[model samples]
Structures are given as C-alpha cells and as structure tokens.
Target: MTERACILDTAPDAVGGALPAPAAPAVSSPESAAPAAPRRDMPRERLRTAGASALSDVELLAILLGFGLPGHDVFEVARTLLAQFGSLRAMLDAPPEEFEALRGIGPAKAAMLQAVTELARRALAQALDDKPLVDSPGAVEDYLRLLIGGRPHEVFVCLFLDARHRLIRLEESSRGSLTRMAVYPREIVRRALTLNAASLIVAHNHPSGAVQPSASDRRLTRVLRETLALVEVQLIDHLVIGTRDTFSFARHGWS
Candidate 1:
C-alpha cells in the first residue's frame, strides 16, 4: 500500500516554519489506476524541433527538473512550484534549502536547480556588464529580481559595480532573517575597498513577500552609504524583493 500523506496544508514555498513533506500524490485504491500521460512531445525535443520559444512554462520547468516521479507528475510538480513561489522569475530566485524542503525535491535535483538558477542569475549579471550606468529604479528591479526576489530568508546582497557602473561582483553579505540581519558598515567598506568597487546596490528580501522597506531597512541603508562614502564607494540604491512585490529605495530617495 502506498503511504498516504498525513501532512497538512503547510506550504512548500513559505518561509519561517517547518512542515512535514507531503507524500507524493497517489490514488486511494488499485482498482482505479491513474491514466498514462499523453504522448505530448518533450520540451527539449520540441525545443530542438520547434524552438525554445514554443515551449510552455511547465515544459521549460519539466526540462529543468529532468524527470517526473511515479506518484507526483512532473507537470503537477512544476505547477505546484510556481503556485507555491508565485512566478517563474521568483521561483528561479529561490534558494537551495527552500527547494530541498519540498516533497519530491532530492539533493541532486536541488543541486541541479540551484546551480542552474545561479547560472541564470550570473548570466543576467553579465548582461549588465556592458551597460555604462544605473539611471533608473526599473533597471535596478530587473537586476534584483534576477537574483534576490524569491529567496526564503533575508539575504543581504551587495551588487558591487565599477566606476562605469558596470558589474563587478554580486556578493552575499549576510544570510538570515529579513526582520533583522547584521550587515556591518565597516566590513561593507572593507569589502568594497578590497573589490575596488566604485558603487553599490544593496538588497534584501522579506520572507513575508511584501517588498516594503521598514524603518529599520531605511536606517540600515543610510549607515551603509555613510560607511561606503568614507571609503569613496558611491551608494546607488537599495532594493527589497519579495514574492508578491518589490520595493526600491532609489525610487523613493531613501538614502
């Protein structure tokens, strides 16, 4: 007999608490068997035959996850991931551990997904490499969403840029609670100096997925700017990315 999932409605994507992993979805009895999946072409096959542009969201993700299980179907899993996290962009931004917490996600798949996600992020970062300047908050959001928006915890990352405002490094400064994380100003300056970065864009996530900066967040940006200025690194922006929304300090002129 297949083990029934006793787990409740605890979300696979939500942060801050642990929930039992649900058993893979299964039929109640052997009499009524689930039907065989239809013979739709695989995403990669279609990508090769038709093109990547022709594949749907589930197809793309199915290609990413590689294979589906007997109980939990690949398409269902992909949809669950999107529903749990919110969107394709957000799901791509989610951390490894968060992905691991899901029922069917194993270490290998987690590693694969994490590696691919970071690769995609760095690809986006590289796209910014040829740009000459940071002139708008929208540009900043495009950058942040590619890296930090859907993460489970509060990851304080600093995007260090060169004098021309081109990319230098995407550094994770701290990793923990969104409500409170220690980001040292002295260390920030030290790292910026060591990296020879000319400007900075700071970002953190709200696991609540609100993206609205709190009073403390505003205050933290001010401190980081002051410290960076002492060492001559300009503070360009602060971004907060959440599943449901995003907040930009540059747009509001926070610091």
Candidate 2:
C-alpha cells in the first residue's frame, strides 16, 4: 500500500472518527527566551549593598518614596521635590499641603514627608531626655531649629530642664505675628516652678530668616534671664532660630 493509504488505514482502526491535527511546536527566540537582567544600581539595591550614608539626597528620598504616579517614577518625583525645595532642610520644613500639591505626592505621601521632620524632632527630643544639654549642644540647637525655624510667625518656646540639664518638658510660651510676639516672664517662672525645673533654655524664631538678635530680643532675654534667676531656675541659653542659622545668646556673651 502507498504510505498515505497505510497511515489512513491505521487512523481508522485507532478511532471511529478521523483524528484531530496536532498543534505546532512553540518556536524559541533569543529575546523571548532570555530572563530579564537584574538591576544593580537602583536606589534599593545601592542602599542594601552600601550604607544609607552612601546614597545621595535624591536616592535617599527615592527610597522613602517607594513608588510614584502613572507618569512619574519615584526617582523623578524625588528629583522634582529636591529641585523645588532647593535643599533637604527646606523640604523637611515644608508643610504637608506643599507636598500634596505635587503631582505624584498625594495625602499619604505628604504625610510621609511631614512625618520625617517630626520623627527627627522626636529622636532629638529623646536624646535630650536621656543626656544633659551640656553634653549635646548640637542636638539642642538642632531640636530647636526643627521645632521653630520654619514657622511663618514668631514663636517663643521654653525647654524646662532638670538639675542635670536634661530636658523636663518643652512648651510654647507665646505665638505672634511675623514681627512681634508677647512673652510673659512671670508666667514662664510660674510654669518652671510648677514643673520643678532647675534650669531652662528659651528659643524663638525670626520669620525673616535673620539670626541677629533685635534690640527687643536682647531686652527680652535680659528680663527673662533675671526673672528666672529669682525663681532659682538658671537660664542656660536663649537661641534665635532662623531658616539657616542659629544665634545663641550664651555663645555670643549676651547671656
């Protein structure tokens, strides 16, 4: 029998009906068969291989911002944020609304950015609570800056300290307009007495970004220092916080 006839005769014996055709084998192409290449230089990878300190500001922020909106990626979003704020410090000081206004940053992302500053402030606060201000002068200044440096209005804050100069509590003594604020010495003394604080450090912010103490600032410091002295609470320092710098009355021999 012919080969085609022989095959047909065998097929009929295997089943009552004709058999269905088999599917063609899948063809393998170089591009289709190869696995995706691993990314070595992404922010997460670099952060894992190297220390966090080794990452740039953009990379650090990109790690915090895990993902971005449809059109923008995390790296692009981080770059835009840094460019808009000009510095990491400025970004830390930004309000949540500012972050939310960005295209890729919604309420959740805004809260994350705002939390960064708060977390830093709380960490420094914990340090102060554990150690004396004398041992952590830089931490004290940093804490005050984070607390008030970016305020649009003037704010007077007091850090009540124990006999060892460890922080007992921090409170806002007064709040005012861009250029003026009312601070009551008696009220501060009363609060210190109530808290049984042994010493205190006071701070205020200049909305204009100037660290120089004004004539009023000097007078207030003098009065507050003398008033606290009467109540046996030593005034350790008075700090004037600006956006970029801090003026310490004690450091400048004004205390």
User: Against the true structure, what is every candidate's RMSD?
Assistant: 11.0, 29.0
Q: Clashing residue pairs in candidate 2, if any?
A: none
For model 1, how does the per-residue alpha-carbon lDDT over 1-255 read when each residue is reduced to its tens digit?
442211111123334432233344333576664443432345677889998889877778887776665566776777688767656765666667778677667777777777887787677666676675485456656667666666566778888889988778878988765355666667777888899999988887776666656666767777777777888889998887775457778778774
In lDDT terms, how accurate is model 2?
0.77
What lDDT does candidate 1 reach at residue 240?
78
lDDT tens digits, residue span 193-238, model 2: 9999999999898776677777777777888888888878999898
TM-score of each: 0.64, 0.77
The RMSD (Cα, Å) of candidate 2 is 29.0
lDDT, model 1? 0.69
Give each model's whole-structure lDDT: 0.69, 0.77
